[model samples]
Target: MYYQVVKRLFCIAALTCSGMYAQAQHTAVKEPKDVPAEWSKAYAPFRMAGDLYYVGTADLAVYLITTKAGNILINTGLAGSLPMIKRNIEALGFKFKDTKILLTMQAHYDHMGAMAAIQKMTGAKFMVDEKEEDVVKSGGATDYAIGGGVSTYQPVKIDRLLHNGDTIHLGDMNLVMLHHPGHTQGSCSFLFDTRDSSRSYRVLLANMPTIVTEKHFHEVHEYPGIAKDYAYTLQSLSGLQFDVWAAAHASQFDLAEKHHPGDAYNPAVFKDRAGFDKELAELKAKYEQKMAEEE
Candidate 1:
């Protein structure tokens, strides 16, 4: 059964790779139409909790975590928003030169589109799970390139390969990596301590699975037994020692009003002990129930 699940996930990853890239390649040929209100030319970046920043986009969330050495970026915004991401980062009282690490939550086009651009701009090393390195280096697995509106991205060299339970260090910040396989074989979350003086931990889950149509799932190659695995991953992550949460997409669990900006109410409030326990319980029940339904 485990092998079946793993095989299913691998196949799905390949299909999603193709589908993702096709969209990016096509989308890159045209000027983005119908930009969102938050992404409007004059919109400003709002603060979330800690050092994380959300410039506002349905596709990707731009996070900046402050380390004693330098700030770390969680994920780059979508392909069409690279310039804005750069501008927003600059507006936040920091320069790209201060960015030391660029972490990809997963290899999906939307999450990684601006990776190459950000790396060039900031000279930060890129990190992804070793399992997905081949998929990423081969021009991406999900077939999409979210690397800013830029047509081409130099393949990102992996400076570090994160494994489950491995904690990544950035001066004062310690980001623990969790390899949750259901979203993508290599999908991961950067779990770390918040900047609060009290020093609580927080998790930035990358792309939480949405129960879109099966075609949508198949396009991304939803794995066969992954429904159960994803549930388990959530259950495991819920046990970790963090009280803050963020993701590449800002849509889950209402971490804040409008957006998760540092200046906004600290999203860490959701990561508190009570909230974390509640969220994990709810997520476990939700996904477990969904898996039974599929059975």
Candidate 2:
């Protein structure tokens, strides 16, 4: 009986130590040394649609959706992105502290690096797609594709777990969360409606599923379903209908060509259906080619 009791105690102790060790690793993490210049380069913020505004860098894209209750911030760019975001928000006459909810496009270190800091400062509830909860909480340390026990950002706590087709309610906004995994397990997109003085518009903040890992899905033993996930994301995003669309990166949607720094608040500037469709087709073609290579 004593031996059995000791065995059980040993198992409990092992579990406790494991959990503590994981927490320590997460706490000790910092971003990689090789920082991209464009990730932090300043960009002029502008209104994309009625309530949605651009508040990110020249390459990395972050968006703010204003509401009467508060505001919903989506996709805090790489680490150290808070100061820039703050400046952009202030430039647009919005308070950073007024952010009530935080969101993300993907769980990559670049996209989620500032989430923890922002959440701590604003006391905003951080919500993520159900599949991304673990990765976000772990600060990208637990990501299947790129995680190597060395984390890239401070871990964030999830206030709510979102699922596909979930409607996020914030004041007068009803942003629908679309789970478009494969970039990471829970990489997602947002779809919603907002209006200007002239007309209403449907806006899609699409999280494009650009493959970032090695060429072979079989190589990623951590995520056995990665191949299927990528296929699903590409197929799903292609059929989505929207009046205006933007992506996680400015170049992805051709921001410079569409809007200038001092341009007017014309939502029509983003109504490039042909551009979005062409990009989607090109991405789809690349995926098919990758699949062929895999075979």
Candidate 3:
């Protein structure tokens, strides 16, 4: 009888210890509060291909996918960028009021700062991955990337919650969502088909698999499995097939080199298989190096 009582006590003690460890692992990490100035600069909107348009800023990326039914707007840039995005969309001969849906690659302040404002202005339904819904609803306050830092923006409502492999259809266009977490819990990549004058091209709206935290793996309380998630995201990104790819940031796609000042619309420049491969390799290398360092 005494042996059984002692065993029960041990089991309860072990369970209590496990619960304490989990609570500790979920403690928020600190984050920087400054918003980069360059992320707000507006750029001219241009047609990427077919009905797809680049309506984002010089550094931040926003894409407008237009169709007869309505339009889909992706990435809203910083809070100060709403007017620029509205103007850019108008410049492309698209009406902001016609936007039916709003989406984002991640819920970072830089990427989603103007989302709430845009949604309010256009009355568009905001869609996001289930994991990111809380982050979006709280602006940047609840984000794992934000930790307990002072990063935040206007809170936006999530109208639709998405999952991996789910399809978002607007008019004749269909965008396949690829859940590539780690950058943010709900960082997503999109794949779809678009056409230019004579040919159809598979386009990938890539969500980069870059690590943002300076915290070591074990030290990341807000996002405990961030390193593992990044590994999975990198692997998922490498296997994706697309004729042309653009990322969350314009710099990731060599936007300046491909579409310079007064340069004619040439989608061919974005079809660099070698560049994509190099980027993937470099990202993977960085992830590995970070992991080693943390170890």
Candidate 4:
């Protein structure tokens, strides 16, 4: 009886320790090294522009951009993160009526999870790629490319279907759309040029890389053609000049590293055109080599 009692106590202790560990992980923040601790709240917020705010969620980030032309937003995180996003925007002293265009790169639920709600709330125009419109309307699934793998995502509609090389203007911003299809059939990106106080214009590239997640979050399978398209997509994009590159999960790489006081990664790592070319060449070489071996 004493042996059984001791065993029971040990089991209970083990379970308790495990529970604590799990809870800690659940609340942990997964962001670049520069992310501040205060940004670890359930729905932490960041400022991107004078009147624009951003919020980071588990797998996505939402931006609230306001302009004289109208209010524009980019990327809405997960469905559950909407309330916090709304609250964050409200705290910035703007009502939902102020939002105009609700633009997203793709139809991944995390990127567009709050689209329906935001559209309903602000009556904003949600724009997406024409190829992505069907997928969204059909409520189909997509393979988000992340690194070499893919993850699943739910479908959603794009109120305004966009095409490659199309320019959409908002206030003083002229955003050019680029169709980057390695991540999804309709995976696209946005580009815009901003003039600094020095009167020099710089381009901003908001890339939507193919996203892949672990099995726990894997909700869809990859499309067979995604790998082929990703290579072509990146190569085609190399010609564009962008001073900054931002994405959903990661921020502008340069900004992220710069923001981290002690981070080893430097934005200079990607600054060299030759070095960037070499990396791309190597990636394509590896892919070709693997394909050759299979053949």
Give me the candidate number with maximum lDDT: 2
A best-first ranking of the candidates according to their lDDT comes to 2, 3, 1, 4
Give the CA lDDT, 0 to 100, for residue 267 in model 3: 78
Give the better candidate number (1 or 3) by lDDT: 3
Each model's backbone clash number: 24, 0, 0, 7
Which candidate would rank higher by lDDT, 2 or 3?
A: 2
Question: Looking at model 3, which ten-residue stretch has the lowest summed lDDT?
Answer: 24-33
Can you give the TM-score per candidate against the true fold? 0.69, 0.90, 0.86, 0.64
* Descending-TM-score candidate ranking: 2, 3, 1, 4
* Candidate whose TM-score is highest: 2
The 0-to-1 C-alpha lDDT of every candidate, in the order given, reads 0.62, 0.88, 0.83, 0.58
Kindly indicate the candidate among 1 and 3 with the higher TM-score: 3
RMSD of 1: 11.1
Residue 233, model 1, lDDT: 71
Task: At residue 195, give the lDDT of candidate 2.
Answer: 89
The residue pairs that clash in candidate 3, if any, are none
Question: For residues 1-295, could you state the per-residue lDDT of candidate 3 as single tens digits?
Answer: 9999999999999999999766543433233347555577667888887777898888899999998999999998887788999999988787889999999999887788788778878899999988898777656777765535444676787789999999999989999999999888899999999886789989999998777756777787888888888999999888988888888998887887788655677778788777888888989888888888877
RMSD in order of candidates: 11.1, 4.3, 10.4, 14.4
Candidate 1 minimal-lDDT segment of 10 residues: 142-151
What value does the lDDT take at residue 230 in candidate 4?
Answer: 63
